[model samples]
Target: MTCHICNTPSNESFQVKVLFKYDVTYYRCHECGFIQTESPYWLPEAYASAITSLDIGLVSRNVRWAPTVEAMIRKWFQPEGPFLDYGGGYGLFVRMMRDRGFPFIRQDQYCENLFAKHFDVTDQPAGKTYELVTAFEVFEHLADPVATVGEMLRAGKSILFTTKVLPNPNVTPETWWYFIPETGQHVALYSLESLHRLANRFGLQLYSDQHDLHLMTAKPINPTWFRWFTHPRKVALYNYLHSYPAKSLLDHDFQAVSDSVRKQPLKDLI
Candidate 1:
C-alpha cells in the first residue's frame, strides 16, 4: 500500500475489527509515520449517522476550543476577515465563533447546518479565499487525506486543524482510545512527524502543539506567538481584558434579517 500524505510505500502493520463487524487491515508508512486503514468499504454504513453516538463531548469540545481559536485569530490571522469550517458538523462551532465576533462560514456536505443557517460555504460568493480554514476532529475520518487537505488549502491561506496523533512506540487498536473501533470513522491517522511531512508537501510552515492542535501557513510566524496565544490561561485572560472588545455582529445580523423580511412581496410570502 501507499501512504496518502507522502505517497510512499507502506507495509501492513496490524488488523482491527471496525463497526463491530469487519476486520480491517492497517498500514503504516515508515517515511512519514502515517497510519491508514485499507480503503474504508464500511464507511457508508459507518456514517449513516454523520455524528457518531460515541461523541458525547461534542458540545464541550467546541466550547473549550473556541477561545483558543479566537486568541489565535486575533494574534495571527485577520480577526475580522472571512473564515471557513470544513466538515463542520451541525454548525455548532460556526455559531460559537460568530457569536464571539468572527465571521465564519460552514462547509459540511453530509451534516445539516442546524445552528448557523445562511452561512454555508454554498451560500458564499465564488472565487473568494478565506483568511483561515479550520477542520477539527475531521482529518481522522478522511478517506482521501491528501485531496481533502488540498481542498482546504485552495479555500484559505492558513489551515488550523485538530486530530489526535497516533501514539508512538506502543500503539494498537487495543491501546489507543482514539482508535474508536466501534464507530469505524477514524481511517487515517497521523503522527507529528507525518504532519510535518504533510506541511512540507504543500510548502507550508507548520506549528504544532504536538498533541491535537496544529497550524499550517505560507506566512512566517514566530512559533512562540502561537504557543502563547493558545495557552488556556492566555485565552481566558485575553477575553477578560477585552482590550479590543469583540465587534460582535449579532445586532447587525438581526437587523439585516428583519429588513429582508420586511422587503418581501406579500404574494411571494404566501
Candidate 2:
C-alpha cells in the first residue's frame, strides 16, 4: 500500500497484537520513514470510545505541557488572537488557556466538550482564521495525516503539536509505549526526519525538541530560542516566578454565561 504522507509504496515492517485481540501488520514507508498500520479496519471497534480508558496520563500531561506552551505562545505568537485546541479532550486545555487570558477554543470531532461549555469551533463563525493551532498527542491517532494537516494549515499558518518520535534502533514491540497496543488508536508513527518531510510538504519550517513537542510555522525561529522556549523545568520556574498574562477571564466568563442563560427561552433553560 502507499504511504499516506508521500504516496510511495510501503513495505511490511512488523506485526503486533492490538487491543489484546486482533493481529495487526504495520508498514514502513521507504521514502518518508513513516510507519502505518495496514488499513485499520479495526478502528470502528477501537474508537467505540474517543478517549480510551488506557489514557491515564491525560490530566497530568495537560498540566505539565501547559506552562511550556504558555511561555512559547507568549514568546512567539500573539497572546490575544483566537487559538484552537485541535483534538482537545474534554475541553480541559482550552479552559486552562482561557483562564490564562488567551482566547482559545476547543475543536474535537469525537470527544464530548465536558469542561468548557460554549467554547468550541462549531460555536465560532465559519471561515474564521486562527493565530495558531495546537494539537497535542493527536498525531499518532490520525488516520489520514496529509488531509488532516492540510485542514489545519488552512485554519492557521502555525501549528504546535506533539507526537513521540521513533528513536534510533527503535525499540522492541514490548518497549515501544508509542505503539499503544491496547487502545489500537495509534495507527501511525513518525521519526524526526519524517516530521521534517511533513513540514516541508507545506513549505513550513519545523522545529522540534527532538522528542515529542514540535512547531511548524511560516515565521523564522532560531533553533536555540525554540529549544529554550520549550524547556519544561525552566518554563515551570518562570511561571512560578512571574504573573502570567496578568489577567484571568474568571468574572468575564461568569458574566457571559449568565447573559446567555438569561437570553435563552425559559423552556429551553429547563
Candidate 3:
C-alpha cells in the first residue's frame, strides 16, 4: 500500500496477532511516518454494529474526563452559536452542551437517528460552516487523515480534536496491544511534529497537551492558559485544581469554571 499522507511506498514493518484466522499486518512509510493496515483484512462487518451497541454507562464514563476537556475547549475556542460534534458517538458531548443550554448538532456514520447531518470526511456540504467542530478520539481510525482534516476545516470556523498519540518510535507487534487487529482502525500514528505539519499545511494553529490530547484552532489565536501560566509550580497548581476527579469539591469547582468560561464571547477572540 502507498503512504496515505505523502504517497510514498509503504513496507511491511510489523504484525499484530489476534484470534485464530485474524492476524493483522501493518506497513510503515519512512518518508512521512504514516502507518496503516495492509489490505485484504480491514474492518469487520460487525464493527459498526459493535460501536452502536456500546453501553451508555460505559460511554458516560468516557466523559468523566469532560471537565478537563471542557477547560481545554474554553481556553482555545470561544463557544459561539452552533457547534458540530463530528463523529459524535452516542451524542454525549452534544447532550452535555445541550444540558448547559448550548445549541449543537451531532453526526455519526453508523447510526442515522442520532445524527443531524450524515456526511463523511470526503462528503461534507460546501459553504456550510460552523463556529466549532470537535472530533474526540476519532482521527486514529481514519484511512486518510489529511483528507479528513481538510474536510473538517472546511466545515468549521475552528476545530478541536483529540486522539491517542504514539509516544515511541520503535514499532513492534506486541507494543500495539491497545489497537484491534480486525478493525483496520488506529492506522495512523501522530507525533507532535507531524501533527503540526499537517495543521500548518491548512493554516491551523495547533496546541497539544502531548500527554494524550491535541487541540487546534483555525486562526492565530492562542489560549490564555498557554500564555499566562508558565511557571511549573503555577501550572501544576492550575492542573491540580482543574484535574479530572472521580468525585469531590475540586470536580464541582472545575465544572463551575467551565460553565463560566463557556459563557464568554467567542467573537472577541476570533
The lDDT leader among the candidates is 1
**Strongest candidate by TM-score:** 2
Give the Å shift of residue 35 in candidate 3.
1.6
Q: Which stretches of candidate 3 lie over 4 Å from their true place?
A: 17-23, 44-46, 50-62, 112-127, 221-270
What are the per-residue Cα lDDT tens digits for candidate 2 across 214-266?
Answer: 99998888888778767778887666665554577767877988999999999
For model 3, residues 36-95, the per-residue Cα lDDT tens digits are 776534455535463533234535544544444444444555444456778777666666
For model 1, name the residue pairs that clash.
none
TM-score of 3: 0.69
Model 1 Cα shift for residue 220 (angstroms): 1.9
Each prediction's whole-model lDDT (CA): 0.87, 0.86, 0.60
Q: What is the lDDT of candidate 2?
A: 0.86
TM-score-superior candidate, 1 or 2: 2
Give a tens-digit lDDT track for model 1, residues 1-270: 999998899999999989988999999998878899999999989989999999999998898889988888877787887999999999999988988899999999888889876678988888779999999999999998878889899999889999998778448887889989899899998999888988988999889888888999988887887776668887789766753867776777678667877898999558
Q: What are the models' TM-scores?
A: 0.93, 0.94, 0.69
Candidate scoring better on lDDT of 2 and 3:
2
How should the candidates be ordered by lDDT, best one leading?
1, 2, 3
Point out the worst 10-residue segment of candidate 2 by lDDT.
Answer: 237-246
